[model samples]
Target chain A: MDFFKRQLPTLLVLVLGLGMIIQYYIPTTFSQQVLKNVNLWIQIIAAFTLCIGITSLLRTHYTKIRLQHSGWAYSIILYIVFIAMVILGFYRGIQEGTPFRWLFDYVQTPLSSTTFSLTAFFICSAAYRAFRARTMEATIMLIAAIIVMIGRIPFGDMLSAYLPSFIPGFNDMAGWIFNTPGMAARRAILLGISLGGIATSLRIILGIERSYQGKD
Target chain B: MGIIQKVLNVDRRVIYLIVFLAVAIPIIFPLNLPVTLTEEVMGVYNEIENLPEGSPILIAVDYEPSSSPELNPMTRAILKHCFKKNLRVVTTTIWPTDGSGGSIADKLVEEEARIAGKIRGKDFVNLGFKTGSYAVVIGMGEDFKKTFPKDFNGNVLDKLEILNGTHSNGNSESSLPNAAFSQDARAKKINSLKDFSYMVCIHDDSSVFTWITYGYERYGIKIGTGCTAVMAPGNYPSLQAKQITGIIGGLKGASEYEKLMNYRGEGARGMDSQSVIHVFIIILIFLGNLTYFILERKKTVRG
Candidate 1:
């Protein structure tokens, strides 16, 4: 009984996985129905998962505030803003000309912009400190990155102007790097990732891994 | 400290300012660079082109404002194609926070539909933000009406003319009342994934891959994805294996798609900035490497 109980979830996952895989080749009416039902179930489960993630985030912050932890003050602020956003979003729609819209327009959008904009800062700092040209590979990568950057910006043209007129098509060269070499590198990474993803997913379905059960 | 050390330890704020300028100046004064269309992008285009005009296609927007720069343009381009093809579009978003992102797509299609004199409830419908994630997407494949239950305005499903054969499926010849749309539509159209002709997912998240596996593997419906540039490369193998028909990565993909559709929208404009910015990043990487090489050589000599 214990073994069955432990293995039940994995077994069900496998059966569903196999069923889904089989449904692809056979173009029968019944197979289509099964696929639809499976998709619906996935959507339902995913929706529930979203709530769980958001709730946990709230719980962690709120608990910190309650306990008055060393950084509890920041937690309190986070919780307040989070809860306020939720209330405004759910209770009052952020329709045009509404107070919720104001909150969304002024607070949410700006804050989001600010957050993403900080990526530029972090990228530069990391580049300065971590992007060492210690090896041939590193040196090549650094050169590619810099050429691509200059080729992109107005400064590239300005810098090129100072160079002897013989170095033609500096901007075009940068575009070529992105469109060709950069694309090739990115594609290679994607191919590796996809293979890894397929392997990982298959492993989970075949019961080769049970870490999701928290006993790993 | 030392003179060289002080030079290397330039103010962190200065770095931020430089990066800000790199990303900002391009936005302010866009470039008119040429954009080359890759086979990957063309693959996505060809897949949509081959589908029958009136085929029902599910368009899922699975991202939010945070990823708008990359995703929004892709979504718009897909919407343009679906609408132009006179394809029956079922637009839905997995995340509620991405309602605005969906709105961006919605507004574009609506404007186009209006210009072309197409009615909403009849020709196309915005299913809006559904609460479920992968479940909702899966459920949609099974039974769109059951999963959505209502349109964005909360109108009851049975009443909607779009589902119940109230409107003819684009081609006047297929005007047969959609008896398939009744509650039985779920049971009939979806059992496994083969019921739909194609599914277009514009997302930045990973879980959407389940749709490719579960939907494509089971149903035989071709899957195409549009994702942020960062997420694009990861889908390459899937494309290579032909599990996914095609992918549009980042703003550039969106721009190419937009041009293909003959609809020059935000995507086309965004490309000018994207191209310039990409070149800027390449230069920064080069400078950093050059500085490192020089400094390393000096250190080695001293040693």
Candidate 2:
């Protein structure tokens, strides 16, 4: 039973994979119907999963509030927000005419915007606190960043105007760095990542990786 | 000693205020930065451009509210290109969270379609959010509607005149009458990548290749992507292999796309702020290193 349980998902996946591969040659009517059923099942599972996530969130917070932890005060605030938002969302609607629109537009949007905006601050602090010109490599990175920064702004043009004309397109050099060098570097990384993904998928298919199944 | 300590230790709020000012000043006063289009972004443009007009295209809006700032511009840029070429578009989302609700992708597509004078249920159709991870995508390849029962507005997809040519009353393989075709007959015949021209994945997540392999791979459909700067490099090989036609990574990619299309949108406006903050970070780094060096040298001399 343990062995079957362990290999069940793997076996099912193989069967599904075979079905998918063979569906290509079958009549569109038959293939499309099978595809449709699979899609509906997925939607059903997704709906249930959303509930699971919400329940997990509530369970963790309720447990915190129940135990009266040191940070229980914060948990209270979170619960209030979560419950209030859910009530507003479902009771009314997210349409512009509804009161929930205020919750969505003012609260949720701003919170998210503010969180995203913090990346700028964190990046700045990280750049400063962590950046050390300790080696030639560090120096090069610093200079490249500076050049890219300047190149991206209008100031780069003003600076380049004062310099010699020998450096053609120096004003737009940063744009070129982003377009060419940055893109080339990025492409090389993406290719490696894709290959890694393919390998991982193959491992799952071949059952070489069982970590996805819980360890005994 | 006290004075030195006071000078070194500043409140965190002060730093925040200064950074806020640094970013705000640039935005309030626009800087028409000299921007040149990168090949990566231009490649995205060229991919859409090369496609014959009225070609069907699948656009996966696989992001939620959290990633709107990055993915929105990418979507807008691609939409502008597609609409300009009169390409038939089918938009959908993967994430179930807020997927049924007011998703950013849903709002964007509606707003763009309105502005571009594209008719809904005709020019473009939003299949809304489908659940099931890779399963939803794979199912779409086999039978488009089995995954999406209704469009965003609760209309049966099979009933839509736009799908008349592609999906039959009885089956997906059977063609509908020419009179039933919405605006473009050819667009209706597109059941998969073999039917559509290309696909563009505008997402914040890294699982774009999963769709490429599952959906596009079988049909020989070309795939391209737009993602955050951090997610950009990971797609380079796909871009290199020509599996993905091109990529627009982050705000910079959006900016480049905006420039190439000659339509100044959010990417152009955001460029000033992005550039300014980057410069401020560089200055902070310089100051930090200088402080560290000076303090270390003094300690060394005293010892």
Clashes per candidate, residues 3 or more apart or on different chains? 41, 8
Model 2 C-alpha lDDT per residue in residues B1-303, reported as the tens digit of each score: 544334344455666777888778767887767566667777778888776555677888876566677668879988877776666778877755443453555567778878888877666787777657677776667667655668866679877755555321222432323323323535357454465668888877765877777766765767888887767766766776677888888887888888888877788777777777777777777777777777768889999
TM-scores of the candidates are 0.73, 0.79
- Report model 2's TM-score to 2 decimal places: 0.79
Residue B203 displacement (Å), model 2: 1.8
A1-216: candidate 1 lDDT, tens digit per residue: 655656888898799877777887785999877766666666667668778988998898878888888899898788777778668767765444446556655666567757865775787677766787778897777677677556543456667777777765455666566557766787777678879988988998998977876653
Q: Per-residue lDDT of B1-303 in model 1, one digit per residue for the tens?
A: 655455567687877676677667766776554455667788888877766555666777777666776677777778777666656566667666764424534544566667656677776666677665556555655665677777664567656665554444445344234323322332233222355567887887774576776567645678898988767756766776788888888777887788788765666677666555455455555565556567778899999
lDDT of each: 0.67, 0.71
Candidate 2, residue A22: how far the Cα is off, in Å: 9.2
Residue ranges of candidate 1 with Cα displaced over 4 Å? A1-51, A89-107, A136-216, B1-7, B49-53, B95-118, B164-197, B262-264
Score chain B of each candidate by TM-score. Answer: 0.81, 0.87
Where does the lowest 10-residue lDDT sum fall in candidate 1 chain A?
Answer: A92-101
lDDT of 1 at A13: 79
In candidate 1, position A73 carries an lDDT of 88
